[model samples]
Target: MEWKLLATVFASVFIAEMADKTQLVTMLFAADRDVSRWTVFLGAAAALVLTSAIGVAAGAVLSEVINPRIMSLLAGSGFIVIGAWVLWQAIHGGA
Candidate 1:
């Protein structure tokens, strides 16, 4: 197994998720009087795990059918496009 790769992914995702909406939603859930904090944590963790699993599985399948270089370019372009859209929306007060 690639320990370094695992660590890199974990760190990258952990940092990225620090201020993510999912974390904020989990916090909001935990703050409710009727909701248990541990339950919220567990539910959020499970959801993240499941989503991550799906991403990994999809990536594995894609890797088999697509060239990694092309995949990387596509992914990068997707992020750039999304970022630009968000920026445009923010500038236009479109939210």
Candidate 2:
């Protein structure tokens, strides 16, 4: 295993997940008095693992068909377009 690649991916994902909806939802679950903290941790961790697995599988299959450069461009463009749309909505008061 490439330690550098592992560290890069781990750091990227850790930062990206910070304060995201998943974290928020996990917090909510943990806040509930009746729920076990262990259950919340396990459930949230399993869900994240499952989603990451899906992403890796999808990327593996897509790489067989699409060039990595094109994929990166498309992903970056998609994020830009999404950000712009959200900004436009905010400026327009969602009207």
Candidate 3:
């Protein structure tokens, strides 16, 4: 196991997930008086695990055909585009 890689991924994902929509949604679900907190936790955990699995599988496949550097560039550009779009929408009162 690549300990360093594992730690890096854990840190990155942990920081990114904190206070994000997924966490907020999970909190809302747990807040419902009828819902068991364990149930909410399990559901949220399963969803995150499934999505992470998909991401790992996709990355594995893509790394075979696409250069990592190019992928990084593309991801950076995508984030920039998304950030700009969100800023534009916010400035426009989210129409």
Candidate 4:
């Protein structure tokens, strides 16, 4: 196993997830008096693992069809476009 790759992915995902909707939803579940924190943790972990598996599978397929450089460019541009759209919406009061 590549420890460096593992740490990089872990840190990137951990930092991104810190303030994401998943964390918020998990927090809400944990706050509910009747809900079991262990159950919430298990459910959240399972969901994340499943989603990650899908991403890995998709990437595996995509890599066979597309060059990595082009993929990176597309991914970066997609993020930029998304960010611009969000900013526009914010400026326009989401109208």
Tell me how far the alpha carbon of residue 48 in candidate 3 is from the true structure, in angstroms, after superposition: 0.5
lDDT of 2 at 19: 100
TM-score of each: 0.87, 0.92, 0.87, 0.91
User: In model 1, where do residues sit more than 4 Å from their true spots?
Assistant: none
- Quantify all predictions' global Cα lDDT against the true fold: 0.94, 0.97, 0.97, 0.95
**Model 4 poorest 10 in a row by lDDT:** 12-21
RMSD values for the candidates in order, in angstroms, are 1.5, 1.4, 1.6, 1.4
Off by over 4 Å in 3: none
Among all windows of ten consecutive residues in candidate 1, which has the lowest summed lDDT? 35-44
Q: Please provide, for model 4 over 1-95, each residue's C-alpha lDDT reduced to its tens digit, 9 standing for 90 to 100.
A: 99999999999899989989999999999999998899999999999999999999999999999998999999999999999999999999994
Candidate 1 at residue 95, lDDT?
94
Q: Write the per-residue lDDT of candidate 3 for residues 1-95, one digit (tens) a residue.
A: 99999999999999999999999999999999998999999999999999999999999999999998999999999999999999999999994
Error of 4 at 1 (Å): 1.8
Local accuracy of candidate 2 as per-residue lDDT tens digits, 1-95? 99999999999999999999999999999999999999999999999999999999999999999999999999999999999999999999993
Count of backbone clashes, every candidate in sequence:
0, 0, 0, 0
Models ranked on lDDT: 2, 3, 4, 1
Off by over 4 Å in 4: none
